[model samples]
Target: IDLETYIYWSGDIGRQFAEALAERARAAVKVHVLIDWIGSRKVDSRDLAMMREAGVEVEKYNPLVWFNLARLNHRDHRKLLIVDGEIGFIGGAGLADIWQGNADAPNHWRDTQFRLEGPAVGQMQAAFMDNWTKTTGRVLDNEDYFPELRPAGDHYAQVFFSSPRDGTETVRLMYLLAIAAAQKNIRLSASYFVPGALTTEELVDASKRGVNVEIIVPGAKTDVPIARYASRSKWGPLLKAGIKIYEYEPTMYHCKVMIVDDVWVTVGSANFDNRSFRLNDEANLNVYSAEFAAEQARAFEEDKTSAKLISYKEWKNRGLCTKLLERILAPFRSQL
Candidate 1:
């Protein structure tokens, strides 16, 4: 299991999950856990000791150091879970208390996660091992971790594992290509939505070409208010191009999903922001399945019912304070 954040181990959900993993370790399961060092800074030392005592191999990615300042910003933001190399899970939810309940209450995040069982599981496991080896300096190659996989579903899927070390924005390029090829409709659900200039222009152009483009983002309740401000700062062009934007009203919306033309569905931890594209190690599952896309589209529609639409006129008439705040934060858009 690869978790971006694994803090609050004493909480109800966290404790139960930790206990389950420890039990599995005790049962002779080959358990390996990798967590981001900065994201899980608050994770109790005792928790790590417990897991290690149970024979679970645990490692932290990129521990903080003054000499490695240049690499501090790059984080392993991917969330993955693979069991016996037959099943895999990936998405935006982290192993923390904030992801426990529904999004109706404060601090309870709205997130999305998907399970896969098939050849794709191998890809997900390989992605995990790529980071696990880098962190622990131990290569994992065994039938227990890379078992023979068979077709488990009819859906066609491809895993896009991206990192800053690749010297290219692979995930961002994928989004741009998908947006360019969209014919009818494009629906996106992003948490941090400070998109770059090229992506913004592409989205605007897509909206101009008679495509029904809609985006669901977090509202004033977002945890990163600065990121939300930065995101809203550039909504003018998209709004003018007839793109409809909705803000989830209940809580922090942490889902990163995109559905194009009701056929292509992409979901995972890749947010529509520069940090995700250029700094963090992200993974997304691009699926070509009308059935899955329909399900995701239905969920988007339901989320819209709880969202508040932003009109062009209303956005244009924003107060001076808000505009000034946006200007003050514009330069930091890339880091958001």
Candidate 2:
């Protein structure tokens, strides 16, 4: 309500934010919609058509079968919206279509997205443009996409982007770095958790060091039954190593969050699984700044408090056949 700039997302909490956003977009400057084709699953052919008709500039990253997208595996998993190019929103949250709620239902979802205001918003615009160029094959040098991207509010922030094509193992490295930086604690919440060896080792090592380590993966998932069981395969080793594990039974958790020592916080589209680290195009934001870290840390704790904590005893009680299936599926993390 103060500045001409605003950033909004539309999944769950983001839905309320999106309606307000639509009004602002139509009456004010300009609205740029950037979303992942895979993440926005409920967003179908009709939805895209309506968005385009609404005068809101819309673009889908790595469009699955669109003739424009020759490579189907590569998708724009980054969910960001830039209002007037000076403020932006980026995180695990996609526009509300399928993701609606949290922990209790495991069938719903648990996730969060942030609205950022600072010089960093410019970098988000740049990330959007990079994807836009790749998807549309159009040069975005014109002022229409990026007006005078200026700071509308005070906050220290940075925008980070990565993909199979971007040429940097940034998403994985950032997670490793945050884990390495943890001194007192590490908390991770994800809907999916088939972590890479590095991530797996870090979580194990952190717990061994007497650092409090906790992880949450969906007990119920929005995907395949085999994949859900596959995710549970590695939990035994992790729990045996002293890492506390929890499965949200009420709904499928899609939250991608990690808080390390209350000094570092990460939020975005990347999961701890190998598919995110090695296969899919992903995005994550690391905030070293104290304020954002605190907010993120608080959110992590709140979610943790409301979640179901898994016990080693219960995990060990599962049938031997179930355990075997997970390990067999574990090797395919890179392909998932």
Candidate 3:
């Protein structure tokens, strides 16, 4: 199994997984891990040493140094797990205690993780190798990493990967094209809901055209208050165009998913914010299957049960302090 995570914070959950992976390595199971240096700063050196003692192949992504200071803003924010080049997992959930407990608990994030099978797993593995090669300068092209895969499901999926160094924002362009082509409805669940001007305009236009456009975003329980405010500041334009906005009330909503017309579904790490679109490296899976889209649509409906619909009247009647905060933080939306 090959795993990549952004944050591996020090905690019982982190230690437990590290120990489990070490046990697998001791049993002659091939285990390789890649973690971001900045994101996993809290991981103790002793823990890494123990993994190395167990013969687990581990590497850090882009260690911070004076020479690489300029690349600090670019982060490998992808979470992937590929098992024997057959099964794959990807999404926003990281390896930390925050994701272990109930979402209702304080500091416990509500996120989504996905499992992929069939030929799409190969693309997921390739995405992981793309970063692995850049970080370690070692190309992994063995049959174990890229085995022949057969169709295990009735769906067509495409993996879209984006990075700042790629000279183009592929993930962002994917979202733009999907939203632009949406016909019946567009259901989006965004942990961070700051969309660019063109994207926002397209969404509003979709709503104006009588397409059911709804978005689920974080509420008061969000960890990043400034980002929440920035997201709220952009709600006016969307609401005026008859777009429906809902905030999940049970916990911090950390899922990045989108479904269009009950036939197209996207699930992965890229959020609707500018940071994900322009700065961070992200990977998303676009599935073209009515059955899969129906499943995701059901999840969206279940989430809506815990969400509070934000009406245009309510947004207009917000308190003065709230409006001022949104205005104050709007300028920094790009950075957030």
Candidate 4:
């Protein structure tokens, strides 16, 4: 198990998850957990002590060390749960109270997680082990974690990951390549949508070439208003080029998904922003099956019903105060 945020709250969803892991550990399941140090700041040390006493091996990724200050900004934002080399789960949801419930209340955030049981599970395990070895300096290379898997379905899928150590721009390059190859339509759902100049240009060009492009982003219920401001600053060209953008209205929208041509789909931790593409370690599952893509596209359309579209005229004639905020935060777009 690897997560960015693993908050521990008493008598809630967080408690339920913590106790489950502890129970498994007490049963001699050989559980190993990895969580980000900064992201888990809300975690109680008592819970960690309980799990440790139960025989769970837990480690924090990139703890504050004087010599490691250079890489402090780069975090392990990947969310992965691989069980016995057979089942794997990946997505943007973290183990916290905010991610609980069915998005029925404002406190319950909207998110998505995908479960897998196929040949691609091996790759997902490897993605987890990549950081595990780096953090613990011990390789978990055995049949318990790398058992042979058979084809569970007919979908052609690939689980890929990117980190600052391997390359800074691999996730960005993957998104650009998929966007450039789109010939029919693009349905993008981004929690944070701060696209740089080149990505903005590509979307505008795709719109010009008659590809139906639409994006969904967080509106007033965002966790990072500065990111939303920076994202809006770059949307003038896209809106002018006839690309439709929508803002979700209910609660915090924390889904990261992109579907192109109704046949190719990518979903996971990486958002459509510089922080995810260049600064943090991210993972995504790309599925090349029309059947699966069609299901996801239908879900995207369902989500659109809860969103309100932003017109170019409205964006152009916005209030001066809002425009001022965008300009003030424009220089820090990369950091957002």
Candidate 5:
């Protein structure tokens, strides 16, 4: 199990999650947990001690040390859970109070998690090992971790990951290529929707080419206020190009999913902002199947019902103080 944020709060939900893993460890399960040090800052030491005492190998990624100060901005944002090298799960969720209940209220966030099997599960395990190896200088490269995988379904799926360490714009290029190749429509649901100038241009071009470009983002329930400000400031061009943007009204929309032309679907931890595309370690599962894409489209349409469309006029008439805050955050857009 690997997560960005694993808050060990004093809530029943938190206790249940921590104890579940500890129980697994006590049952002689080789439970290895990796969490981002900064992201899991709210986690209690006693909870970690309890897990460690149960024989769970827990490690924090990129702890603040003197030698690691230079790369502090880059974080491991991937959420992965691989059980016994068989089933795997990946999405944009953390172990926190906000993720306790279903998205029936404002406090519970709206998110998505995919439980997958087959060869894709092997790729997901590889993605986990990519970080597990980096966090601990040992590799788990045996049959217990990498066993023979059979096809679970007829979907053509593959997992790809990107990092600043590679000095390549992999996730960004993937989004651009998908946008550039979009023919019928592009339904994008991002929690953080601060697309930089280049991506904005690509989206605008897609909109101009008659692609029904629709995006869903968090509205008033956003955790990153500055990211929302920066995102709104750049929506003028997209709105002008006839791209439809909707802000979720119920709660925090923490889903990072994209569907193109009802044929391709990519979902995982990568957001539509520069922070996810450039600075953070991200991973996405790409599926080239129309059947799976249709299912995701159904979910997107349902979420759209709970979203409020923001017109171009509304965006233009935002308060002067809000505009000033956006301008102040413009220079730091890449870091958002």
Candidate 6:
């Protein structure tokens, strides 16, 4: 329920979904709503009021306290929606009013989510149930909460959850393992470029070893200017190591995707930044099918046409004052 993972689909799309979901709920579709207190603090009160009146059981995960710094860092960064517990939506996408635009509508905020209908739905529900227990301090063993979900589509999938709470090195190690398993090329597009040292080193080393590694990030303006500048400082290392870099010329790029050797693709709210890996509670899907990887790779190739390549020569010429600033923040990347 953090504000960052909201779905933006205004106009007819927004009105239609609101009516549809409300009707289904009224007809006895069990609804389980979970929001992060810290992230959703700025969320409008009117929406919560409406959901409450509609009988949707809404609860906030980890309402932040000034003293619990550790608790505050571990946010429920996952944005998931399961309709009928059969059809599930997971990724950075949220069900907030506006999520759809006309196809090729040039949506500024690029995002990705998979409409999953399989055994994975049960796993998704279980993940939510675990979080629900952690925050609510009560186990939810009710069968109604977790329906006997079955696969309605022909797709093989797995749920990969990440967080500091899970382990000290799982997310970081998992990322590197995915990279190591790649055979051809890697395409990564993220909102923030900052990363853990091992990941930062792995990316450069991958390119140096002749792997086709390409990174697409925000050009100059984005939701977080500090992160943009922080990324610029590291471009020199990545470029020298032979990794190609590009800046999306259009609206702020925010999609976090990794397509590797046409086998695995990582899609979720987890940015390739330090905070996402070491701090926040993140949920992502590591799809192992070649077909799914191809579709995602096609989208990356299409985006490449619009993004501008940032050459190493251009970065070296930036004034010393700005370069100094990026260097100052680069060391503290993990804390961001």
Clashes of each: 0, 12, 0, 0, 0, 4
lDDT of each: 0.87, 0.67, 0.88, 0.87, 0.87, 0.70
Whichever of 2 and 3 has more TM-score, that candidate is 3
Candidate 6 segments exceeding 4 Å error: 1-23, 66-69, 95-107, 149-154
- Whose lDDT is greatest here? 3
Q: Please report the TM-score between candidate 4 and the true structure.
A: 0.97
Worst 10 residues of 6 by lDDT: 1-10
Clashing pairs in 4: none
Candidate 5 lDDT, 1-336, residue by residue in tens: 433332334455556767888999899878888888778787777778888999889898888899769788989888888887888888888777888766799999999888888888888888888878887999988888888999999999988888888787789999999999999999999999988889999999998889999999999998888889999999999999999999998999999999999999999989998888889888888999999999999999999999999999999999999999999989999898
Can you write out model 6's per-residue Cα lDDT over 124-169, one digit (the tens) per residue? 7666776777766766555665677666655577766666776764
Candidate 2, which ten residues in sequence have the lowest lDDT sum?
1-10
**How do the residues 1-336 of candidate 2 rate in per-residue lDDT, one tens digit apiece?**
111111123344444544454565567545556666555555445444544455556656565565746566666667666766656777776555345554445445677878887667767777777777776687666565556656554445577877778667788888887787778998888767776567788878887888899887766445556656766766776889988887765566778888878766778778777667766666566666677778877777676666688888988888888888877876665766
Local lDDT at 156 for model 5: 93
Q: Write the per-residue lDDT of candidate 4 for residues 84-167, one digit (tens) a residue.
A: 889899888888788876467888888888999899999999999989899999999999999999999999998999999887
Question: Could you report the Cα RMSD, in angstroms, for every candidate shown?
Answer: 1.5, 4.6, 1.5, 1.5, 1.5, 3.3
Scored by lDDT, model 4 comes in at: 0.87
Global Cα lDDT for candidate 6: 0.70
Q: How high is the lDDT of residue 12 in model 5? A: 59
How high is each candidate's TM-score? 0.97, 0.82, 0.96, 0.97, 0.96, 0.88
Error of 1 at 232 (Å): 0.3
TM-score of 6: 0.88
Candidate 2: segments with Cα more than 4 A from true spot: 1-44, 54-57, 63-70, 100-107, 142-155, 221-224
* Native-structure RMSD, model 6: 3.3
TM-score of 1: 0.97
